[model samples]
Target: MKPHRYQGSALLLALCCSAGLFLTSPVVAEESLEQRVTRMEKLLESQGLVDLYLRLEALQQEVQMLRGEVEQHGFDMKGIKQRQRDLYLDIDRRLGQLENGRPAVSPGSPAKLPESTAPTAPREQGNPATANPGTEEKAYREAFDLLKEGRYEPARNRFTDFVVRYPNSGYADNAQYWIGEINYVTRAFEQAIVEFQKVLDNYSSSQKQADALLKIGYCHYELKNFAKAREALQAVITRFPKTTPAGLAEKRLQQLKNQGQ
Candidate 1:
C-alpha cells in the first residue's frame, strides 16, 4: 500500500509541472512575436524617411535644370527679336533712299550735284538684262542678291571682291557696310567689329555712319565687352539723337540695364 501511494504522488507532481510549462510557454511566445513586429515597424519607418529625403533631392535638382533652360530660352528670344528689328530698320532705310532718288556717295562726286548729272547714269539704271555685265552697279547688285538669298559665303566673297575692285565706286561704303553685316549675321562678333570699324574710318561722311556705329556697339555687346558697348551706344545717342540707330541704341541700353550688365 505505501509503494502505490508514493507512485501516485509522483505522477500528480509530473502532471502539475507539465501543465505550468504549457501555459507559460504560450505567454512567452506571444511576447516575443509582439517585440518582433514592433522592431519591424521601427525599421520600416527609418527606411521611409531615407526614401523621402532622396526624392526631395532629386526634385530640387530637376527644378534647377528647368530654371536654367528657361533662362537660356529667354536670352535666345531676345536675340531673335533684336535681329528682326535690325533687318526691318535696314530694309526701311534702304527703301527710303531709293524712293528719294538720292545719289550714292562717291569719292569724286561733288557734295551737291544736279539730279540729271548724278553718277548713276541712265545705263546704270537700265534693264538688268541689258545692263553692263562688268559695271560696279551690277557687281553690287549681284552681291546684294546673294545676301538676300542667304548664300552667305558667296555673298561675302562677292562683296569683298566688289570693295577691293571698286574702292572709288559710289557703292564702296555700302559694300564695306554689307561685309560687316555678313559677319554680324554669322555671329563673328570680333571680325564684325573690325569690318564695321573700317566703315567708320574710311567713310566718315557716309550715310551709313550711324548704322556702322550702332553695329559696333552690337558687336561689343555680343562679345561681352559691356563697357565698350555702353560707350558706343552712348555715343550713338549723343551724336545721332533722333535717328533710328539712336533709338535702337536706347532700347539696347535699357536691356543692358535690365540685365544688370
Candidate 2:
C-alpha cells in the first residue's frame, strides 16, 4: 500500500481550522460582555451625581430658613430688652419718691439731697410777722407726721390748715406740694394738676418748682393727655437742666416716644 499523504495533509488542515474557530469565538464573547458592563457603570455614575446635586439644593434651602429664624429672634429680643429698661426706670422712680423725702433744690442751682435718716423740720423763713416760726414748725411737723404714716385724708386736712395759717411760712410750699402728691397717689389726676399748678402760681421761690412741673407732666400722662404731658415734661427739662426732675422728665419722654406718643 502506498502512503496516503494527500489524505493526511487534508485532515491536518481541517484540524487547524477547527482549533482557530474555537479560540476566536471565546474572545469575541468576552469583549462583548465587557462593553455592556462599561455602559452600566457610566449610567450609574451619572445617576449618583444627580442625586448628590439634589441633596445639596435641599440643604441650602434649609440653611436659608434657619438664618431667617435667627434674625427674627434677634429682633424680638431687642424689643423685649427695651421694654424691660422702660419698666425698670418707671419702677425705680416711684420707689424713690415713696422711700425718701424730696431733695431741697436751690433757686438758681441743683442742690444735694440730705442724707439724714429722719426727716428734718424746715428752717425758719420769711418775716416774723407773716410766719410764726415756732407754731408754724410745730404744725408743719404734725402734718408731715400724718403724711409719713400714710394717713392721707388727715394729712391733707392738716396741710390744708397749715397752708391757710402759715401762708408765708417756710414749710407752706412743701405742704402745698404734698397735697398735690396726695391727690396724685389717690388717682385724682384732675385735682392733682390743679394742686401742682398752685406750686407754680403761688410759690415763685419754691425749691419744689421742678418737681411740681414733673408731677404735672405725669398727671397729664395718666389722663391720656399726651400733648400736655409732652409740654410739661419738656418744660421741666428746659427750665431745670441738670436737676433730678429734669432727668426723670427725660426718661418719661423716652417712654412716651417708645409708645408712639
Candidate 3:
C-alpha cells in the first residue's frame, strides 16, 4: 500500500509540472499585434525601402523560428507583422519608382557620326542631313569648350542644335548628355533630370550614365526632395556598382538615414 501511494504522488507532481509549463509558455510568448504593427509602421515611415526591406527580412526570420511554439497572440502577431511588412514594401517600391526619375526605358543603338571634312561649318540648319558630320562634331566640341568657359547660353544652344540636326549622328549620345550638363550647371534641376534621363534612355552604352545618375540624385538634393534624392542615389549604387558614383551614393544614403530625413 505504501509503495502504491508514493508512486501516485510522484505521478501527480509530474502532471502538475507539465500543466504549469503548458499554461505559462504561451503567456510568456505573446506580444500585442497592435504594438508590432506600430513598430513596423514607424520603421517604414522613418527608413527608406532599402532599410525597410532589411528589417523586414530580419523580422520574418524571427517569426519563422518561433511560429509553432508561441501563444495565439504571438502567432497572430507574426502574421500581422509579416502582412504589414509586405504591404509596406509594395507601397515603398511603387513610390520609389515614381520618384526614381527616369531610368532607361528601352535601349537604342547609338548613332555614329561620319568623319569630319576638316570641320569647316558650324551649322547648316537648312541642309542638316548634308552637313559634314565631322565638322558638326567638331563644332559641338567647340560649344562644350565654350560651356567650360562659362558661356551657358551659347553652349546650351550648341548642344540643342546638335541634337536637332544630327538626330541620327553617333554623337547623339554625347549631345544629349551635354544638354543635361548645361542644365545641371545652370541649377536647372527640373529640366536637367529630364535631359539626363533622355541620355540614359537613349544611350545606355554611353560612359556618361554613371555621371548622369549621380547628377540626377544631386538634382533631387538641390530641389530639397530628400527621399527622391536617396532613390536616385541608390540607383547609382545598383546600376553602377562599386564605382565612384556608387561610393558617393552610399555616403549620401548614410547621411540621409542618420538625419532621419
Best by lDDT: 1
Q: Could you give me the TM-score of model 2 versus the true structure? A: 0.53
lDDT by residue (35-65, candidate 3, tens digit) is 7888999888877877889999999999976
The number of clashing residue pairs in each candidate reads 0, 0, 4
Evaluate all candidate structures by whole-model CA lDDT and list the values in order. 0.78, 0.78, 0.69
The full ranking of all candidates by lDDT, starting with the best, is: 1, 2, 3
- C-alpha TM-score for every candidate: 0.68, 0.53, 0.49
Give candidate 3's whole-model lDDT. Answer: 0.69
Candidate 3: how many backbone clashes?
A: 4
Ten contiguous residues with the weakest lDDT in model 2:
110-119
Q: In model 1, how many backbone clashes occur?
A: 0
Model 1 ranges off by over 4 Å: 1-14, 17-19, 52-134, 258-261
Q: What lDDT score goes with residue 85 in model 1?
A: 80
Instruction: For candidate 1, write residues 165-220 as lDDT tens digits.
Output: 66655567777888998898888989989999998888766767888899999999
Which model, 1 or 3, shows the larger TM-score? Answer: 1
Model 3 alpha-carbon drift over 4 Å, by segment: 1-131
TM-score of candidate 3 against the unseen true structure? 0.49
Candidate 2, residues 1-261, lDDT tens digits: the string is 876999887888789777785556778889889999999999999999999999999999999999999999999999767655654464356436534654544444433333422223343456453444455556776887787677889999999998887676666777888899888777798998999999889887777788889989989988999999999999999999998889989998999999999
